[model samples]
Each structure stands twice: as C-alpha cells, then as structure tokens.
Target: MLHTLPHAEADFRALVRKVTMPKPTTTRRLTTEAGAPIADNQNSATAGVGGPLLLQDQHLLEKLARFNRERIPERVVHARGSGAYGYFEVTDDVTGFTRADFLSAVGRRTDLFIRFSTVADNLGGPDAARDPRGFAVKFYTEEGNYDLVGNNTPVFFIKDPLKFPDFIHSQKRDPFTGKQEPDNVWDFWAHSPEATHQITWLMGDRGIPASYRHMNGYGSHTYQWTNAAGEAFFVKYHFKTNQGIRCLDAAQGAELSGKDPNSHQTDLLQSIERGVYPSWTLYVQIMPAAEAADYRFNPFDLTKVWPHADHPLQRVGRLVLDRNPDNVFAEVEQSAFSPNNFVPGIGPSPDKMLQGRLFAYADAHRYRLGVNHTQLPVNAPKATVADNYGRDGLMASNAYDRHAKNYEPNSYSGPAQSDQPLSAPLALTGHTGTHAAPAHAKDDDFFQAGELYRLMSEDEKNRLVANIAGGLAQVSRDDVVEKNLAHFHAADPEYGKRVEAAVHELRED
Candidate 1:
C-alpha cells in the first residue's frame, strides 16, 4: 500500500538549489606537521601497482606515526571532566584579607577557566554517578596562572596526604574482579574513622549534584592570605552557586546514567552556548593567624570544618562561566590546574593534604603532558615570565630563554631576583622520626559527624540511611559491613539502627 508522493516543481527546485549551491573555497592545501605537501594521500607509495610499499613515503610514515601516538595518559583521579572559559570579578573589596592582585580592587576582573568533574569515574563513564565532583579554577591573573583546586564539599575523607593513594585505590576497581568492590571501600572506611564526616555527606542528598551549576564548590584546605600590612589570615574558599542548589535522588541519578551518561557535560555546554551563563559568588572564611594555634580542632585538618559561627564568611567576588571550549580535547583536556600555582599574596598552609597536592599535581602533569605542558596555549600564563633558567624540554614551543645567559646569577644581563621579601616562613620544630598527626586535646572524629546527622531533616536522614545501606548491602563480607555500621553507630545510634535494618532487608531480598 506504500506509495511515493509527487513533489512540486518549486519544492524540488528549492531542494536542488540548496544541495547544488557552490561551497566556500579556501587556498590552503593539506600538509604534514612539518609543512610538506601530501600529493598522493589516497594511495600508498609502491614499487609497482601491486608490489610492496616503498619505505621513502614520508607522508604515509608521518601520518601513521602521528596517529599511533595521539592518545595521552589519563589522570589517576578526576579522569572525567567538563570545562569552560570565564572571569572572576571582585564585587567587594577584600584588601583586608589578602593582597592577591586579582582581589586587589572592587570591580576588577581576571580571566579564568573552571573545570568540573567526577573524582573516580573514567573518561566515558556516567557523569551522574554517586561521587564527589572536582571544582577547580585556574585564574589567568597578572602575576601568573593561579589555580584554586578544590572539591564541591567543604571537607574531605582524609587529612593526611600519605593515605590518599590507598584511599583512591580502595574506591576504584579491584585488580582481580575488574569492578569496584564495596568490601574494599567499607574496609578502609571502617578503619579510618576520620573519614566519617565526609562519608555522611557523600551518602546525603547533595552527593549526586543536579549539574555542575547547581552544587557549591569549596577550597577544602586551609590557606594563608597575607594583607598589605604583611599580617596573615587562614582562609577557606566557598563558591556558592547563583543557581539554587539542586540534587538528583539515587533513583533519578541511576536512571539518567542509562538514559544519558553525559548529562552534566551536555547541560553545561548547552547552557553556555544558549547564553544562559552559570555563576558562583566567592566567599572566604577568615581566621586570625594567632587563633589557628588555639582553635578547638586542628585548623588545617581536611577532615574538619571551621564552624561558621566562629569564623564567618565574607563576600569577595563573583565567578561567571560564559564560554564553552572550541575544541573539548585541545582546550579542556589540556587545561591543567595545580595547588602550587599561588600568587604573591597567597601561600600554602600547614594542611597536610594541601602540602601533598602542591607536589603531586605538578609531577602528574609532567608525566601525562610532557615536561613543557605549560607551554600549551590553554595552560600558558597570561603574564610575562621574567625568569630565564628554563631552556629546552620535550615539545618546547616557547624559547624566551633563548639568550645565551640562560643560567641565573650571571653578569650578562640575565634576570635578577626581586628585591621584595618572600612570604613569611612557616615555623617547624617537630622531630625527624615518624610521628602521629598533631592532636588537639579534645579531638574526636565522631562528634562532627553526629552533629551533622542531628542537623539533617527527617527526609534527608532517611535518604542518607538508604544511600549508605545500599552500598553496604553490596559488601560480601559481613564483618566489614558490621564494623562500618559500628562506626555509624558511634556517630549516631538512630543512623546506625536505620542502616542496619535497611541492610538486613536488602540481604533478605
């Protein structure tokens, strides 16, 4: 019964006219990276029509060689991400807190790029999975590329850097099973009670963010900010989204994983493309340098938070993402952020986690992107670098150090050290041998977690219990599950009881 409909002459002519229209012409010709012309790309060079290929085919050799080495190694953590170009504008004068040039004056703007990501997912994995999102910002400031690498949560699981590798390994897939085993995760958590606070937050409603635009971002570690008077203050950054906070329930997140794996990435790109920009108001919790020594909890502990009542937030600036990447891989993937990239007024604190990241991030970039990764356009600093010590490395694109006097302290007009004094030096008097982390007399890991649980609403509490039990139910070892539940019991008896009941019900089913 199927039949072809007759087309009108006008419609047919219009379609033909569109299809046969002359395309724009370009004078550029195809060439290799070395700029050699590729004359016969369709066929390989051969001794005869049907004979063996010739070795002198430079084009063929170059094409194959380049294609073979195209892929770079992925990050050990935070492998999957989406990034956008933006600016950070100082809305309120924060000269009292820090002398950082970007935050020097009201209404001043610094170009920046922000990358949002899932901490434990692979490059092609579902973006909606239950994992902490990495909220890192790289500010192309006048001094240099200052990077504020942080997470969406205000606190982290571990305070020390030594345990980071082991913790990450436990979260990732098991070597034998080739899948993330809950047994391994629970075992680690059960032993490290310091992780209790972060675990509670992770199991709560805000764990799976609705999108990168909806969740709040935090520079979790305590940092030092020096003012014009050279007085230092311990500060923490909080980027509260202008778009109201939103989250996907476990069911919604799981469903979207199957329906649209790249939901977050697509949402971010499309929103920017449509001119619906996303933004966050920057706030900092400043603690007097002297107060850090006498704080109730270890001020630099990544596992703890400075209570808002004690050290209140002060508005500083606004960050707006308005442009999407032209080429995702070239720009977004190549963009690198590190905690060590600090400005003149900003400096590192004694936070153990921050201390480790200062070294690890730069080392990882060197391994994945070669020694001259900073030479890439996406990572190159907007400000001029005066130093001439660095010379040649693999893929070295810039040669500012081409002058014969590449070495420092040379008489031949080489760059001289600045006369300005460096930031105040941190005082250290600890022993050289292995020692436990500095402890405040009243430190107890469960107190904060308990306080957080008591603050949650009834529905949020129920969801938290369900999320925790859901993962615990998958743990094959009953001992591991029981020990983890005990830790939860120490935090809150009701939380433990509810999760226990849920786990039992799941086991029965």
Candidate 2:
C-alpha cells in the first residue's frame, strides 16, 4: 500500500484492516517454500534406531536436497533487492522513435515487475549502506517480455564489459579473509581511474537513499529504439521519482542500517499498502540512428551519458509500482529477468556490456533456476506464447506436443519462422577484431567520472571524500591511500584534497 499511497490516513487503515491477509492456504498442505509438503517441520523423520542406517528413506533425502539448494546463487552483483508489481502507462507519442508496444499508444497499461537493489552487498546486508541502487524492470507487453536492467546513477564505472567481473570482485569480499578489502578496491580504482565517477557517486550523500521510493532510476547505458517504420533512434531511459530525490548522511545511514536492515524494503511495501503508489515519470532521450556514428563520444560506451542538452529526455510514459507480491518465493524470489528478453520494437545498442548481458543473464538463470525458469508465473510472458516446440525439462507443466514434430523443418506446417517476429536488422560495419577483449579508447573511461565529481554540491563533495577516505584510510599502507587519492585528484583536485585530509586523520589515529 505504501508504494501507491496518497498519504497516511485513517480511511486507508480501515481498508487495510479489511484486506490484510493471513498466510495463504492452497490445495496442497504445509510444504517448504519450494512447495514440498512438510511432513515434519517439528522434527526430521529420522531412522528407527536414530543410528542413520536407512538409505531407503526418500523424505529425508528430499529434506537434505531442499536444504542444500535453499540458496539460488545470490546474484553475482545486485545481490540484495526488493521487488513489486504494477503497471506502465504510456503518456506520450513515442511510436515515432520506437515501436515498442508498451509505448505504442496512450492509455495502454502493461504489467510490470520491478526489482530495486543495492549494487554491492550480500542478500542480508544493510539496506541503507552507501552503494548504488539497481533499478531493473520487466515489462510484460503484447509482443513479449522487456527487461530494462539499470542503476540509479546515469553512468557506470567502466565503458567495457571486459572489466566487469574484475570490478565486481574488487567490490566483493576478499576470498582469503571473507571481508571487504580496502586494498582490493583502492588498487582497482588507482589502476582504472574510470572508477572515479562511480566512486564519487558511491561516497556522496546520494549513496544512501532515504528509501528506494525517494530515489530516481536510470538506464545507465545508452540503448537504441526503433519504430515500426524501420527507423532507429538512440535512447536512454530515466525514471524521475514523483516523491522527489531524498537521501541520508553517513551517520544517519549507519544508524538506520543497524536499526532496520530492511529499511528500504519496508518503506516501499508500506507505501504501496497505504495506496501512496510511488511513481516515476518515464522519459527517454532519443537520437537519430544516423547521428550515432558522428557523436563526439562513443554512443555505445557504458560509462557515459548523452548530455541532456544534446538529447533531452522526451517523456514517454509513467512507471508506477503499486502492488506487493502475494508470495515472495513464487513471485519475487523465482523471478528471472534479462536484458536479452526484448520484444521486437525495442533492442540493444553495440554497448559491449549490454551485449554480454544478453547471453550472461539468461545463462546465469539457467544455472540458478534450471532451463524452465520462465515457466514460473513471475517470469512467464502474459502475451501470446508460441512455445509449442519448447520441449520438456524439469518441472515441465503442459506437455508441449504429443504428436507434432519437436524438431524443426517438418512438412506438417509446424511452427515455422515468421517473416520478422524476432528482431530488427541493426547494421554492423566495423572490422571484426579478436573477441578476447575489445580495444579501449582515449575517452573510454575517465572524463565522465571527473565531470560527475565536479557536478556535486559542496557538502556532497565533502562527504564523498570523507566516506571514501574513511574506508580507504584503513588500508595501513600510505602508498595505497596516496595511490587511490591520485586517481581522485585526476578526477578533480578538490576531490583529491578532501579525501587526503580524511586519510590523514586516520593515519594520525
């Protein structure tokens, strides 16, 4: 209710009392969250002599297996998240730029699932921590599923996807110590100064959002949108919050992290429950397809944003998340969304990270949730599905075809390829180079971070320096501290000086 609330009121409370529900009761009796009936929640159905001799007991095996696989591989990144359901309503005529059905017409309401997450953290980590918030959305439109995976920040740390795994590892806990290593993060940042931009955002006031509802969302990477007329336009999505931008200082964030580890989750859930639906005006910056090649910066680079002056956000729609999931495990936990799951009208750019994710996200889900993950209601397409030939796998529900040919090229007029139900022909001209790791460019990384640092308010800039130094200062080596500060200085002198001061304080201690 809090996700869509007008305000706190007694009438809303009374309505909530009327609808607030109890734990669900299904046809099947009490089972595990994975849906295996619990014959023994009180005690494990052990052997007769309690000697662990019976190998024939299947229930015990089931119990062990269920317990063993309880975790579905916490996301390699964006491990911590809260999700909800709602609708996207087209409010503008964007059909000229992209034929994406969700934006085809006004009053068109498409079901949507949104997952808001902290970029760096385990599933159980503090919600109010100083980190980037992930804003990924999955829209079930008439064509198919469309997943817009993004972050709260408009730009990223690096331009190339080659450094993504390394960047993630630097932020994650050190393998040897099982603790976040300042040395690892600083070393990575010092070497790749492109880290400065994202680092600045991470250490500033916006790092710790007051709540997920109060922050904005960005597509982060530039994308391409095409209309039915076979015309293409470069696009970047921005979800400006109606509630307005709100954030926490370091002390306040620390206090709230301890007091409420699930603060953001609770706030979003509460806001929806109260009918104060949190909304974002969805806007997109559109660029002509012909202009991408001539643009000053590589349009496909992940670490940069097209300046609003050059490609102003043209309002396309409004994204409103108003409903909470009925079952967390079924609806939220099992949900699998990917950037590759695009409908026809919308598509990806040559953005390397986006290209890599096209394969990686679905592959990860296959490992995590088995190949039939999409069969789950949460991830399944509400639009017409022609998956008749998609054969059986684990948890196979409808028998696809008993008589028809599962293999393709049958004379029975089996589901043949449509003229173009799949994708628009995106042109590629550059010489295909070695696929190992793409070449890096002069403007590939650093300048954007420097620009971002220069844009922060005075107080925000100070906090950025202090927050980064407070963590980096503990590195024990002055060389390590100084080395990282040099990268900050390369970003902006003021940025470096303040961080230097904070580091000195720790050195004194």
Candidate 3:
C-alpha cells in the first residue's frame, strides 16, 4: 500500500486550478499581418493626437493600404453568383463509357464545389433577372480537379465563339444610354439566326427560375469520353433537379427583384442550413463516336440539342449539396473553375464554343485570381497532390520541395509527365482554312426552334409571344423587329403571326 504524501491534496487542487483557468487576454490581442500584437486598433498614431497621421506608424499605413486593395476584379461574365459544397456520387456503373476515376465504380463519391450564376450580370445585379443561369461544377477527385462549366439551358444563343463577345455586348448596357437597349439586343438576334432557339427558350415561361434548386443544369456542349478499352463516345450531361422545375412568372420575378435582391442566394443558404439538402440526378446522353458524322444535326453545334428520343438519357449518378460555405468570399467569390481542367478519359469535343472556352476560362481565372489560384483551399485538389514544375507566384502557400529540381528532364528526379495521353487522338484530314461546319442532312437554324415552339402548350405559347413582343416593341428600328419576327415565322407560321400581333398590340398600348 502507498502512503499519501503530506500536502498531496493541496498540490492536486493547484494542478486542477491551472488546467481549468481561462486563457490570458493577451492571447486574444489583435495582430498585424506579420502576427505581431497590435496595441490599439481603434486609434491611429498621429503627430500629436490632433495632427495628421504619422507615416512612421507601420500598422496605420499597412491597414489603409490593405483596405484599399481588399477587392479583386469580378468575373467578366457570370458575375452575380452563389456557391455550395457537395458530393457527386456515382449511382450506376458507367465504366464502359469512361475510365474517369471519379466515376470508376458504383457508389463512388467525389467531393465537389458548385457555383450557380447569372450570365451577363454585374455583381450588384438582381438575382431574379431573366438571364441564362450558369451551372458550373468543380469536382475534386484523386486524379485531379475536373470542372464541368455549363449553363442551365440545353442550347445557347450562338454556335460560334467568335460571336460570343458581340452577343454579350448587345445584352450589356449601351455605351451612350447606360442601359440595355432593345435595338442592340434585337439587332444582334436578327443577324444571328442560330440564336432563335435559345432566344425562344429565354423569353418563355422558364426565363426566371423560382430558385436555384428548382432549375435544371445542362452541360450544353458535347464532350468526348474514352473508356478503359480506348473506345471513344460523345456525351452530354444533364442534371435534373429533384426539387422539380419551378419558375417565377414575369410579375413575380419583378416583385422579388425589387423586394429582395438576394432571394436566390438566401433561399439556397437557409435551405441547406435547415438540413433540407437539394439534390440532382445526373443523366448522360451518349452517342457512339462513329454516328456523329451521319447525325441529323451537326452533333457539335452548341445552339442545337440532340433529340432525346434518338439517344435516351442514361442514369449515371446523383449530386447532393449538403453544406453551405462558412465564408462566401473565400470559398465562392475567389473560387476558380476552368473547362480545361479535365481528368483522364474526358476531353473537349470539336464544339467551337467549347474549344474557345478551354483557353478563355483558365486565362480569365489567372487574370482575376493570381496564377496560384489553384492553391486556394476551395480550388486545390483534395485527394491528390499537384506535383508540377509550377513555381513561385502570388499567394503560393504550398510548401516547396527545395531540394527537388524545379525543371523536368533532369537526373535529379523532377516531376515528369505521364507517358500516356489523356484521350485518343482525333483523325485530321482537312486543309487549315476558315470554314463553316460540315452540313448534315437535317441541319438548319430554324428547324429545332420550330420543334421547340410546337412542343409548348397553348398557354406557354401565349406567354412566349407576349414576352417576345414586350422586348421587340421597345426596339426603335422596324427592320430589326421585322427581321427577328421573320426568323420566328420561319420556325412556325403560327409563332410568327402570334408574336407580330402581340407586338402591334403592345405598341398601340
């Protein structure tokens, strides 16, 4: 038996007291950038308390300098946005179509960040604006980060990327008026016959989504997927909202825009906070590579969608957004996504819009957020290390392997590239020249637009006609309005007639 020491209880009580004591107030002191304690944040050093600020005060100078540069440039497009953290889980076996490790097996889950944005809007623009919603997702997988940059619509305004800047400029505020001019918008549409399909969709009932959760997302561009066997297929992605499609009518959207500008962002945040997670079921329409040549439409056209009947959507996976970002600025605003960020098995198609985006997006991010943007927590790969020769840049926080060589092709064992290519090489036999897309049997600008208009219900047709008329009536130029009306008429005689009548009535009013 051990004998208790004299004053043992006293010593034990002292130890407990030390363990339970509150931390020192000094530990909570405010600090400067270099981590030195700041003596006073409320007061600045001055010449004599009543004089001009002292330049010798390092903290005062640093604070104002940092505050001056607190903001980075916003995105040129898709500026107004919200984001969330989630996971994409493969619910079916899709290994035959693509050897992408993220979708390698059933029940495989990949962490992801999704940003929902409104195209052609400023940061301060209303969320309820009738615009194409951007649905870009960045998946952090073991292979690396994969970004699927897309829009809500299955089609777009123009087929060629060369027209993108002009299309956007027309949609943007006019230089003279500082407002979106109907003449500018309508003139562009009248000239771009390919835009008729997307314009019809845009001015229709679903122009404004009720909330971010209720809208469907589409990988509008066709992509190429190569399997483990090296066989390739063209694919398009669709994310059907489990919450179901819901849209705000023109009146409702207008009211919401005035009353609550942050309605969409707030709705998403609160829904996730209350444990009501939003989910989307992922589907892919796959076409064998050889069939693209003889397809009814130019399969790579960004302004046309493949008819679902020809290639039915196959169930692939589910994406559930379960977490709200703790810090929106750090996680959402600074987040960078690029379509060029492809893992193994997946590659860009011959779609001109997609080919342009492969360069434009990454270049934009590098310009907006420094070259080290990928090293940011939200964008950095979670399951794998980025072992490349990329070196020092702004905000490069990763620990450098100083001993290892920075350049490749070295005996010192620098990071080397994989010997295998990401995807199979495309067959090329054409002379390099400016050319239009190869014509397919049923390829025409107005056919699909007509098909879409004809598929709408009678009520939807009424709304579409009225919406188109409202904007067209504002255009000062009669030629622009008539040219646009002619394209709608080409789609369908009834569609053209209805829009013309509606525009006349609106003009009279």
Candidate 4:
C-alpha cells in the first residue's frame, strides 16, 4: 500500500489494461442471401457521392423489402400470448381409460408446447387484463400431435358455437367508437341466458388471475377417450397449477397493467430462466358414455361443469414447463393449434361447441399461417414422421418424399388410412337441422349458477357484486340492466339484490 515495487507496478498495470480493454471478438463475415461476402455494409450504393441511390444495392433493397413484410395478421382472439417448451409426463397408468400412446405408461413422457393467452386482446394489449386465459397445449406424441385446446375457466359463456361470433363481437370494441361498450356487453349477456354460469365465474374473485402460473386450465368441452378394447368414455381435462391459485382484485390488476403491460410474459420467462420452473398436475373427470344421456344436465354443454361430487377427478399426469422459446416470433407467434388434432385413441365428442371447433380451428390456421403450417417445427410432430400425400403450398419446405405417389389407393404404396376410427361412433337418430339442445332433467340454465353464487364466501360475494355493478351501471339501457339483473336474481336472490342495489347507487351518484 505504501509503495509498489517493479513487479507490483507491472501487475497493477496489467489489471488496469484487463479492466479497460475490449474483449477479443472473432470475425464472422456478413453475407447476402446468396452467401456472397459483403464488401461495404456501412453505406448504401450510390451513383456518386451525394448524387442518387442505386437500385442495384441488393442488400439495401432486401433489408427494406423484408422489413416491409415483417408482420403477419394477428389472431382474432387470444392474440396476446406467451409460449414455453415442456414435457408432459404420465404420472398414473391411464392405459385402462385411454389407448393414447402418450398416456399409455406411467413413466412415459411426451414433448409439448403450451401457449397462454388473453382471450379478447390485441397484440399490444396488457397481459394483466381481466380476461379469460387460453391454455392450449400441443403434445408431440409418438403417434402424432394431439392438441388440447382449452381455457383457464372450466366453463364458457355459450354452449353452442353459432353464438360465438356475436358474443365475441359484443365483447370487442364497438365498430363506431373503437371502444368496448358496457351496453353491448350486458345486452348480449342478458339475451344469452345460458351465459349465466360463466358470467358468475367471470365476475367472481378468480376473474383476474395474478399470473398464468397460478391458474387452472380446463378442457372446457367434453372429449371422447377410447380404450384399447374400443370402450369409449367422455372425459374432461383439468390442469391444476402446482403453484396454487392467486388472483388480483380490480385495483391490483389496473395497477399492474399500468406499471408493466407485459408482466405475465416477463414473469414466465424470468421464472424459467431462474430454473424455477412451473408445473401443473393433470386430472380428468371421466363419465361413462351411457351416463351422458341422463346426466341431470347435458354433459356436452360447454356452458356447464361436471360437479366434482358426481364425477370425482382422477389423477393422470404432470406438465412441467422448463424452457422458454429461443425466438418468440418463430416459435410462439407463428405456432398453431387445432382441436381436431387428435391421435389414435383421443377424439372429439358430440359437444356442439367442440364439433364446430373441430373444423373452425384448423381452418383458421390455414387462413392465417398457410396450409403448410403443420410443417413448422413448433407444430410438427417430433416422435413420428408425417407421411401424407399433401403437396406444395407457400413456404413449403418439401418435408415429404420427392418421388412418392401423390394420391392414395394407387399402385404404389402411398400413405393409406389406418382403418381404425379415432373413437367409437355415436348412434345418431335425430334429424340434422337447426334445433335446440336435447332436453335433460335439470336443463334450466340458472340453477347451477345459483349454486355457484351460494357457495361463495361473504367477502367474495361482496367483491363479485361490486365488480358486476361497476360494469352494469355503465350500461345505457335500463332494459339491458334489468334483464341482466333478472338473470342474477335467478342465480341467487341475495346475490341479485346486492348487485341491483349497488348498480342503482352507482347510477344515482
């Protein structure tokens, strides 16, 4: 400390140099699309100094053109999302219930990609918005890709898909004002009485989830699972978060949205990065196929839930998300999922909404991501090769054999049908027409919702009423407000009375 000798002085000088000097970097030659090395990259080609830019500047032109076409069309719903790579490990032997290869053995694992999204948001919307979260998982199994497209809530607003577009339109911004209108929202809900159960859920304490990791995911539609013996059972999937349920109130959600719009995305990414991976325990409620005919309420109704008392959940597997996407745009944004993407044993049910989605989801992907979207790495099957006769389209990378026959039933053995249907076919008797749902013993729309309201604690009920009134009071039409109140009244008398009083007080103020 007093004085430095010759060696000490040299050591100090070396340390200073090490701290101040730039780290050594390797030379990697930049190239054009054709792999030619670029001589000049700092400036664009010109006729002369400050004269005119040359059109032959391939690099400049290519950059501009690519930049111009950078963005693709956003999704109509669930546009704002975050995705992760994971593995779903079968924890229990479900071979007895389903012949699906992925769930065949207790220790079998299937690679998967999951995307969590806000239901009614744009690309730039805040992650903390009070909206239902889309919890879609694509499992790349040995047989094929099986997509479990679901949502955080166990039930939805409407049972029929015919009303889907109108319901979404009401929830979205008004055409004229470009703002979400309470009048339109409440009006639609008032008219759609079947929406009562889901409305109760949406206005309840769990509406605004604290984070994607803390919420449960449900296959809202009933699906069919066939055993190896060809016995079919109706099934509903539930993925309960291991992290536990956590939610935000109106004040907290608004505050988080303002402070960090991408809070959910950031949280997921950072959690994975820190090696604090999030996981969910998968459970299923199985119903005997024969029981659907007289299950108190329609088992296939998307707007209803199977009571845990009737069909207790059976433990199945666990999904652990351990890796974040390397490139969000290529892996997450461009990813596609479809309810129709089923393997050998798992298949669709007679659920009206589910039946509509089996066609609609795949068609939407074709329109948005092109017919060859399945060839993309994120959507592609990992354990099995796709050997179909599907040919070229935009950006087709020729993932198939070049000399193979293009059509089936040919002299040459192209890909042929498996001969086995995915599930046992239902015996159809009723005529195909625009008809109401088949009646059940307890088909009335309001009783389960009433039960749900009655199950809430005092504080939860208070918050639910306040939250509902905050929106209902802004509705311009008295008839719309009254009709919505009546639906609430049908659910629970005390629930409806409190909400009605709150709305009136707000309107008066």
Scored by lDDT, the top model is 3
- What would the per-residue lDDT of candidate 1 be over residues 409-441, giving only the tens digit for each residue? 888887777775434457689679866678885
Local distance difference test, per candidate?
0.88, 0.80, 0.92, 0.91
Look at candidate 1 and give me any clashing residue pairs: none
Steric clash pairs (candidate 3): none
Across 1-509, the per-residue lDDT of candidate 4 in tens digits comes to 51444456666675587568664485887888789877666678775444499999999998899899888898899999999999999989888888998998888889999999998878999998888999999999989999999999999999888999999999988999998899999999999989989988998988999999999999999999999999999999999999999999999999999999999999999999999999999999999798999899889998889999999999999999999999999899899999999998899898999999998889988988999999998998899998887888888876566678888889887778989998888868868789889888988789889999999999999999999999999999999999999999988898889999999999999
TM for candidate 2 is 0.86
Q: Supply the global lDDT for candidate 1.
A: 0.88
On lDDT, who's better, 1 or 3? 3
Off by over 4 Å in 2: 1-68, 386-388, 421-424, 434-444
User: Which stretches of model 1 miss by more than 4 angstroms?
Assistant: 1-24, 50-52, 419-422
Over all chains combined, what TM-score does candidate 3 have?
0.94
Better of 2 and 3 by TM-score: 3
Worst 10 residues of 2 by lDDT: 42-51
lDDT computed for candidate 2: 0.80
lDDT score, candidate 4: 0.91
Q: Kindly list the per-residue Cα lDDT of model 2 for residues 173-282, writing each as its tens digit.
A: 99999988888888777777666777777787788899999999998877878778888777889999999999999999999999999999999999999999999999
